[model samples]
Target chain A: MSKVTTAANQFAARRGFNQIANRLFTGIVWLIGICTIVFICGLLFLILKKGLPELDWSFLYGLPSEMEEGGGIGPLIFNSFYVLVISLVISIPLGMAAGIYLAEFAPATKFIAFIRICVEGLASVPSIIFGLFGIALFVEALDIGLTIIGGAVSLAFLNLPVLTRVTEESIKAVPKELKHASFALGSTHLQTIRRVLIPVALNGIITGICLTAGRAFGESAVIILTAGVSSSGEMWDFSLYSPGATLAVHLWYVQSEAIVPDAQLIAEKSAAVLVFVVLLINIVFRVPLWLNERKTR
Target chain B: MQSVASQTLIDIHKLNLYYGQFHALKDVTMDIPEKAITAFIGPSGCGKSTLLRTLNRMNDMIPGTRIEGKVAIGGADIYSKEVDVETLRKKVGMVFQQPNPFPKSIYDNIAYGPRLHGIRGKQKLDEIVETSLRSAALWDEVKDYLKRSALSFSGGQQQRLCIARAIAVNPDILLMDEATSALDPISTLKIEELAQELKDKYTIVMVTHNMHQAARVSNQTVFFLNGEVVEFAETEKLFSNPRDQRTEDYISGRFG
Candidate 1:
């Protein structure tokens, strides 16, 4: 009877220990989740608190005045959008074609493997290196002399590897049975890709485009080297050969070397706008995916 | 029980297939008749599905796959230099074991093949979608929800939708590669019933693991073993009195 009582006591103790351990794990998981939420919230709060007061309409639309106290980011904003459009126009078709070739047509030869490795390596290379290369090739060799086209081309190079990888992965993820069904229905390879593959992988392709757009919007190094630190005098000057400064590059210039007295305020407001636009781009892309999920349900 | 009125549509003359070093199909020669259901039965890795894929050259997509001898459809050599593979495939449509509808609206899913073949008018697409869905017996279920995604349908409905997608192209042949294996019993029965009706308009070939399914739905059954055709006979005769000892043993549940 004494031995039975001892055994029962041990079992109860083990059960209590398991309960404590489970509770500890649960607490740790919750703590990690809460920490991430708090960190993001804190960063957003800091940016808004410092930037909201200075973000007036004039500061957004009026031209930047070097000698004046209050200067606007109109040219910077226009140039940012200009450079983004140019880069996306150059990258999307070329990247998607390369991606399709890699995913569908490229054989399993050693040469193909080598190309894949090179693509991955290029993806990991720093943006700064691409910026330097852009200066050498577009600004110096091509004699473009800090033109918007030069900057845009450099940004396209930076976005290409990422877009290609995303496209290949998304295309590869499409079910092989779908391809088989298309081929069985007397569709050629090109027709099948155009009708079935592209539509199915459209979500991933959009995500890739959004990601590259966001990166190009916030990039400073490539723009500074290839597009220069000043825009044309006109607010909406869209000449490809004109010097341009994107928003991120303008922010850096305002913080480091602006002649205006309210440079710090301008920088803070620019940072806030940058963060907000990126967030908006993410939400815009996610809407379609969310609707797709809801409709299937 | 062999039907005398059926005419030969596909003739295989000493066909051999290889996947790199592996001899997947050997000396496979048979005459598949038109406007009838011909079922291929075998154990796993028995080359039944491979032969079905060969009917439409679907195996051409796989790397390192090689074929020898000849396959003729309606007295035309399919592998000849003059024959375009795309046109040949248009003559032969296929359904997979898993229902693989494009992730699109129900109407778009059926209209994909028609559109690829360059049918563009709104009125024409609408008519084709309606008729094809009706042919697959899924019109009433999905008629109101034509704008909804095809994936929203139940598994059985999706399989039928896939059939509708295939039939929209008006192919002369339909190949089903174990098309009902992933479905429930009710869905399987529904597909089997649909196959029976489809054979009146198109030549039907199916690969099935279930012996009873072969016996129940197929008019002619081909039994395959070790990448070779072991027996080819009428479904009734093959099941009741299999000529080969291997066919008899396999049908009697002796061995695969």
Candidate 2:
């Protein structure tokens, strides 16, 4: 009876060890997942706490004035939209075409592999370096003054590598069967891409575009060096040659001790607008994904 | 006794297909008759699907693959430099083993091929979609929800939609590669019936592993083994009185 009891105790101890180990493994994974969610929500809460109260028609629509306490981000907002649209116009087609080449058209070879590595490396390069490049080429060499076009072109170069990678990934995510099915029906490769591949990957592409737009909208270093400090007179001017200040640059400029008397107010208001615009763009981007989910189900 | 040009719609003469260095198809030679369901039955990896794809020059899509023999459709060598691959494909359509309907509205799925082939205007496309769906035996089930996405359909309906899409272009030949092998018995029978009806207007070259399905739907059957055609004859004769012992063994369920 004593021998039997000793064996049972040993078995129980072993089982207990395994149970603890299994629980610990599961607990660690769960902790990681919860922490990620908590971190994201915490960051958003912090930004909103500091930024949301500054949202008002006066702060949003009123023109900037030296005497005014909370003038407006109207010019900055307009400039941001302008720069974003232009940059996307330059980047989307070129990046998407390059992405298509990499994902679908590039023949497997050493040169193609080298080009792919370069693209990945370019994506990791600093944004400030892009600003420097822009100042050197567009501002100095090209003699394009500190204008919206110059800023937009700079941002396009910065965003192209990321945009192309995302587009390629999304395009590649579409099942090969879909392309094969289209080809079997006699569609040319170009036709298949135009009709089936693009439409199917539209959500992913739009998501990438929104992310790029958000990055462009919040960009400070590139806009500061390339586009300059302020718009030329009119807030609603549609001219690309005019100097522009995007939301992020406006925040940075206002937060600085120089020039702005109401630095805190200006920073808070600009930050609020920036948060709102980013969220809005993201929501708009997700609409296609929602529709796709509904359609597939 | 008849010349291949007169009776056959798709003529394959010494058709050799090589995938890189490995010979995938070895001197495959056969003729597919016009307006008939011709089934290619063989063990897996016997180049049955390869032969079906060759009729429409679909093997051109694969890289590093080359063909050493000629495949002619309607007396024109499809491999010729003068051949317009797009036009040839429009004339000869295909349906795959898995049901692959475009992730679009049921109407759009049917009208896509026709629209690409230059049929414009909503009314014409609507008519074509409706008629093609009807021909594929899917009209009654899908008439009310033409605007709904095709993914909502059952597997069988999706396959039928694919068939409708293939036929919408008004192709002279329809190539089906084990199209209904994924469907249930009831769905398989329905597709077989649709195949029978389609043969009146189009030539069908189907590949199937099911001996019963081959016997039931096809008029002519070609038996393939080890990348070569073992026996070719009328479907009934091939099943009941196969000249090749390999064909007999396969048909009798001895082994593939």
Candidate 3:
């Protein structure tokens, strides 16, 4: 009432209001974060609780039963890993080469921009579309039928654009100062790329590789269309001509169409395995990089 | 003002550079003395660094950049068709404002340039690394930790390591673009002293924002403004007695 003009008193009401609002906002954010973590944990728990008891070595490596109570996914598991390795072998080098060319060697032209757009568009395309393309190329064109090679080539196609984008971004993220330094030392552009840029961008590239690897490992639709719904029924078939149904495909098959009485149990266990391995892939790839960073720093 | 006559190592003739539609440097011509330090002083965006880059053809990396000039180093026209850019760069080394030591061991950092030129022997690489580090006044401090990562060093030490790396290739000319602008005062003084010693063997051309650094380290000084050379003279005479109003005004801090 007396119109006190002290600095602290002048803004006291606003300051107090701000403090309350700040705390309220912080509380809401924390609650949201905790809820998200709880949801994820609940999902993981639901799968593991129903599946972990049934999971065992023989169940993982035994042959399937058409009308019996018990069946395993040994050949399916083998196909999953085999297809993954082959696809990576096909995609990694090609993708990284394309990425390097785009980032370092491509001239600043409209044609180059168009190519970049094409790569980005392909990276976002649906995996099912790639499966269809695989069918066109392998099943229709080459007459190979549903086979491991077809599945792997289609998976490679899916992986290529993602890998290229990730690699280009990673290389582009390397500091300009590093490139300048290398060139100043009279190193050729090719030499600088190999000796400096690749090494520096390797961490981000590896992370991209892990992410794509996880996606490809658990991929279902592509394998279903291109590799078929059945494995060769052998534990270790290395031939590319074999039917390459993977664990993810088998999980879907058991739940939807398989005649086995314990199909639900098998699906649950395989889903758990899929999630667990995806999580494991990221950790395994990143730990060595983290350790090396610590050792240097 | 006295002009000390010396053998010319680098001769620029009517150099004009354009970044697409924009003219970055115009009609720049100067003769750099052999085995002496020449400093280029100008404000930011004054084309000082651009001219320095032209010496080694580093500007070739920039897209939409065009040049019409003859930059002859040691009597060879570097811009001519027969001149291989890689070989020219090998003869003319560069250091940048920020200390950019590779993410490698200190020994490997110094050895990288030599290795690129095909010095594969362990003993030879060891010797080059030692001599280069000693030349940069960094050998004693880093000798015990030669295996340590270059990125692990302090700012000043890392800059010295970069200098050592540049020298390991044994270039005839060294171009430093604000090499000490990012360093502290003590480190700056250390580098200035190092530059003074380096001038005895290599022709050094440096572009610096610091007027004091130019006065302290350079034998010849060139003042540039708006892509034009305002004055070029011996450093001592130019500092004490100016011949051009723009150069004097810039030197006196009237306008940068």
Q: At residue B17, give the lDDT of candidate 2.
A: 90
lDDT of 2 by residue, A1-297 (tens): 577755554445455788899989999999999999999988878787887875778677767765546667788888888998899899999999998888889988999999988999999898999999989987889887899999999999999998898888888999887887888777888889989888888778888888888888888999999998776746788888899778788788777733656778788767877887889988977887898767754
In terms of docking quality, model 2 is medium
- Candidate 3 lDDT, tens digit per residue, B1-256? 2265789999998999999998999899999999899999988888999999999999998988999978888889998989888778888999899999988889888999998888999999999999999999999999999988988888989998988999999999999999998999999888889998998889999999999989988999999998888889899988889899988999999988
Rank by DockQ, descending? 3, 1, 2
The DockQ-derived docking category for candidate 3 is medium
Q: List clashing residue pairs in candidate 2.
A: none
Instruction: List ranges where model 1 is wrong by over 4 Å.
Output: A1-23, A286-297
Residue-level lDDT of model 1, residues B115-220, one tens digit each, is: 8888999999999999999999999999999999988889999999999999999999999999999999999999999999999999999999999999999999
iRMSD for each candidate structure, in the order shown: 2.1, 1.7, 1.5
Give TM-scores for every candidate, taking all chains together and pairing residue i with residue i: 0.95, 0.92, 0.94
Instruction: Write one digit per residue (lDDT tens) for candidate 3, span A206-278.
Output: 9999999999999989999999999999888899999999989999999999988988888998888777777
DockQ (0 to 1) for model 3: 0.69
- lDDT per model, in order? 0.91, 0.87, 0.91
